[model samples]
Target: MSLVELIAQADERGLAAAGVSCLDRCVPLLGGDDEVLRPLWASLAEDGDGWGERVAKIRGHACDAATGAGAEAVSGPRSGPGAEAEAALLARRMLAAVPAERSAGALREWADTCSVAALDIHRLLDVADDGNTSVTDCREGRTEGMPPLVTAELRRQVTVLELLAGHGAAGVRQALEVSAEGRRVLQAVVSRRARGRT
Candidate 1:
């Protein structure tokens, strides 16, 4: 199903998880630890109020990490010039994208924005640099190419929304699992970049 159609049918819980999952996948861009967003996921799983607090904590951590002063030191150090500042800026945008309250409209907006932002952040962090270039080019009537990694991410995002639309609350667990898979993919990408730096 199309993202708009899926979002139009999602309930509040599905919408909330959709937004959180997007941020969760892009945590590495913030220089955040792998588990930093775990509590937010837990809150969604339990349908509790703790997600707000967890988001706050993550925002602070992301800010510090981007400045090279994280409480939990980042690995290998960001060697690219201005990369830290760029990561921090993207992190801020991610946090801001979270809806202030639970509503399908709000969550849909957040999810849509995150989809584009996460792709941009990944492109910025990718060693290859060509991964998302064609996506932009395609939009500009210049090229039809999209890197496989980016294509997979976009597919996963659409699938999550579709699952939520199809099964409502019952689909939450499956959606979370899909989000986790995306996170693992991004984590592997981060690790690969780290290894290449040495």
Candidate 2:
């Protein structure tokens, strides 16, 4: 099913998972450890009821990580200090994209916005781009300028949301696997960007 159709059919839990998974996978953009959002994923997987609390905690952690507060220092090097600020802004957008109520409307909004936001984060860190083509072009019709890794991440985000929307709770595992794949792709992107700085 298409992403719109699947989202229309998803239940509350499925919708929530769709949004959470997207944000969870994008954690690396904030220079956060990969496991930072694991608790939120665990909550969804086990049907635990503390989603709000988890979201709050994650927001705090994102803030700390952005400011280099109590959070762990990201191990690899950075593209530059400005890259962190751009990444942090994108991470904040992901967090804010989520809504308080676990309704289909909220999830749809979050899912759509988060998908674009995640791509924007990748574009911000894509230092290789020489401005001949923009991410906006990729969304339009020009995919040649976009990196394969970023393309894969965008595809995964859409797939996860579509799966949840189509299959609801029954599709959670598959959706998560898709999200995990995206996370791995973004991790590689992050690593490459860091290495290029050296």
Which one wins on TM-score?
Answer: 2
Cα lDDT for residue 146, model 2?
Answer: 76
lDDT of 1: 0.64
lDDT (10s digit) by residue, model 2, range 94-165 = 776667555568777786676566666766666664535455555443577576545665566557766755
Looking at model 1, which ten-residue stretch has the lowest summed lDDT?
69-78
Clashing pairs in 1: none
Clashes of each: 0, 1
lDDT (C-alpha) at residue 85 in model 1: 46
RMSD of each: 5.0, 4.7
Q: Name the TM-score of candidate 2.
A: 0.73
lDDT of 1 by residue, 1-198 (tens): 445455556677766776777787877666767677676667666766765677677667766765552223234434453443454466567776676555568776776667666656655565555533754442233434555566666677677777766776577778878888888888787667557657
C-alpha TM-scores of all predictions:
0.72, 0.73
lDDT for 16 (candidate 2)? 74
Give the number of the best model, judged by lDDT. Answer: 2
Steric clash count of candidate 2 = 1
How big is the positional error of residue 5 in model 2, measured in Å on the Cα after superposition? 6.4
Clashes of 1: 0
